[model samples]
Target: MGEVNRRRFLERMTALTATAVATPATLGAIANAGSRFPGETRAGSRAAAGRPDELKLPPAGRPQPAELTELTLAEAARLLRDGDVGAVELVEAYLARIGRWDARYQAFNTVVSRDALEAARTADRTRGRAPLTGVPLAIKDNYFTAGVRTTANSFIFEDFVPDFDATSWARLRDAGAILLGKTQMGPLATTAASTPTGERTTANAWAPHHDDVSPGGSSSGSATAVAARMAASSTGTQTGGSITNPSNAQGLTGIKPTMGRVSLHGILPLTYTRDHPGPLARDAVDAALMLQIMAGPDPADPRSLGLPPVPDYLGAVREDAGALTHPERGGAVRIGVLPGFLDEPEPPEDPAPDPDPDIDRIGSSFPRRERTQAAYRREVATVEARRRMLATLEEMGAEIVALDFPTHWEALTSFNFNNVRLPERSEIFLEHLRDDVRKFGVSLAPWINGLLLPAAEYVRGSRARLVLLREVLDEVFARCDLVTQTAPFPFDMVGLPLIGFPIGFETGSTGYPRPIGGMFGAEPYAEHHLLAVIAAYQRATDWHLRRPADPGELRPAEGNGGGPRGGAGGSAGRDRSPGRYDLFDVMERGE
Candidate 1:
């Protein structure tokens, strides 16, 4: 092992020993639990010995082309399988929807309708038995697809096309999935979708006319596409909170699987060790199915080397959505709730009011306090909504445990977090920095910060990460089946699995409903547990079923363009403060 790897292992061993001493019973149970590797199927894991030949279809019915766009991935696949809906018809439905709605929502950067139709025609002839066969998906722009314009929404690779598909996309494609197009993303997976000139592109499907509501970042377009029924489902890559934040913002179910769950072979790098690719679906069951197909070891990515087999993620949720809530599978699910997670975090103390940095000048036109207050109110409503949801789960015999985050959570997430990711990001995009830094636009400041970060600080931050990971695994996860109402930082740092699903909606100041999301995180390779909880929560609530109003039918308010082109909702000259989480800022200003 390299020196750094050795040190990390030693630090984890020391922390684990201390953890075992502190809570012998809890540690004993964790120890008794076999391999935590994501590839290993845990005891009672619902996955069968080999790929099952069963068709997991839902109630069969054929909706009109426009209506068919509203069906979840599994539903669409079922329709195609049962012969009630032709694959060509399904593809045509989504293509038509994208043609009408995508122009307004700006969800897709590139829509290959011709290719999708051709794939659909093939599906109709072959009638493939794969779970995702003929299902239309919007892939994040960063994921490389052979012969597709795989722009990371950046000028650097605007014309770059790959010779082979990204492992994640390849897996989905080989499973008979059809790509509708590459969805827009934050340039280099940093912020909201914007042009080389810094104009915003995508809008939240829930309220495309309301500039006040953000679609969420990096994976914003991916989430918007599915939420607006433009695609059956989509893929997203999360380096910080890219997948979870957008999934939360758009009222979709997004799973950021364990760090190495899905191979990142052909995707653009953000934070090498941090980047996680997963699916964004309309609901938990769809998310589970998409994840199952996309996850596993890939020869292209050494990080994805031998671990354990991908567990039966779809079966875990499908067989019994509420199985994790009851002890029949093992112990009744223990959900860890961090106190004050829903409340706004305490802002950093400022002794001397530092002059606002120049980067702060480039942001939205909305007043800072107004936007902050709105986000705060939304969080308050989110807390109440989640409490009610949890109450329902508890009544169903689920256990909700109050747990404190690690002692250094605030410090690690705040100051030290940036140090860990920035250096690597700087290294990855060093050429861009060396050539023309201005091209980075709003993302430039952080890139420069990473460039200037001290080597010693980076090393220290890297070492501290192992300590934090050990604490999360040994301390927090030891007692809970999942962590509820999650924050993305520490969990991202520790490389655990997180599932984001809509809990409810908070009415925005503009009288439009803004999606409020809840999350559940589990130990590495514990996606089965996370999916089980979310699937059950979704089964009990109709929040995931809520779809945004049709953008084409809605008229844009005066001064705000009806499309994503130019509007009051644009992120023009406004506050560019770093988000609540230092890793990736999708929610700080709610854009």
Candidate 2:
């Protein structure tokens, strides 16, 4: 074992006796018993015990509708701008909701009730400078929030607080956005748990009672917080599918901005090449509003394009850029589509009666299913939804461009996370890990402590990825304003900006509800075009407005006994095909 790995094992030996490996049955039992994890309980179920916040749900000290928490950020923004609601009342409404329902969802790691109230009060007395003024928002725990405990949902830095804000947070603060609290995140912003340190398991809002489903990760809590309406919007960082995957599971609209569009200063790194801090919200316009407020260049982070002047993203959305005449096509858009994106692969011709040959040989009852039939129902729905969306675009004069860049699915799975990305992550984080040990308040999450690789392999892999993605993206982008595709995409490898939102949901024989979303991509700086297309669709559709089943309402519903991957586990991979031509494929074929 490496030096760091040895020390981590030694430090964890004493605590090992107190913890047990979680199994499906134990997890379900723990959730059904009302405490999903230790030190946590459902909404309004507090008692005389741990922290004061755990004691009871407090009143907001103001009059507000219970449904105010359910309002979209766009709706709330209109009221705030039109003088229908004051910043303080809006803040109180959100606080009351958090105090009431957030316990069940367990979306936040820390609730800054007092600080949020003060900020809202200031917005009422001062002149606002930006679009999201007085709009309450949740900060991801990984982002640096001065004076607040910005633990990255990891035990290593449970008490660590930064003296400065990430550029994204600083910009939001300057815009008069109220900070509700730091929402939970994947451990060290790299795993599914917000805090797997002791016994804190942040449950998904869609299926709180069962272990069969997930809200998605590593930005698991951010998407859930917004989907469950605990916050108007929340920031989520994506290295792979962290933003979009959770959005798909929770039925929320999420944006993974082009890399470096939002400065990463003070935020923990997952992959320096792929990490993007973006917003998860109600719809495209709301996401556009956040982009306008949070994006821009910061000299501190050299990766930031420092684009001379940021565009008026909100204004552009309103301008209906998707409807604008393509100079070449004249009042039409060219949209790119990959037909196989969302479809289930056809079974092989003349298939054997027993497809599960391995299972039969091993004497098992059945072959392991990777995903649920309920999820496939949504996938089929998504495929149909994309076709309808395309028809609408064509009706409005969009020319469909069939695309054949088949390498993406391979890129998603084969590229770095725990493999190629680990060495670079370790180089950047080891010092912090050592410091984390000295200033520790909780246990170290295993992945961060155990995974290490040589820097040579990491660098070599990263370069190849950049080259392949850049070429493929250029080939497809040249023919379209925005490229639309289905889930399980590999867009993150090249840091492409994508807007992910649910197309539809369905229930299968299992009786569990499944949600599926689609991705809209544009080359790096073309976020505006992508937003325009999405905004145009959103204006004509209500998909983004759909909400998931409330966590508080999750009961013992009948579900099929098969264990579906359920889009949890933070897994991303491309489908295997002989057709795609990646650099790896070329090396193998000697082309």
Q: Against the true structure, whose lDDT is highest?
A: 1
lDDT of 2 at 132: 61
- Model 2 clashing residue pairs (backbone): 409-574, 413-573, 510-560
In terms of lDDT, the poorest run of 10 residues in model 2 is 582-591
Per-candidate TM-score against the hidden true structure: 0.83, 0.75
Model 1 lDDT vs. the true structure?
Answer: 0.71
Report how far off residue 385 is in candidate 2 (Å): 3.3
Off by over 4 Å in 1: 1-60, 319-322, 325-329, 342-373, 555-591
Number of clashes recorded per candidate: 5, 3
List model 1 lDDT by residue over 174-214, tens digit each.
77789999998887887777664456677778777655566
- State the TM-score for model 2: 0.75
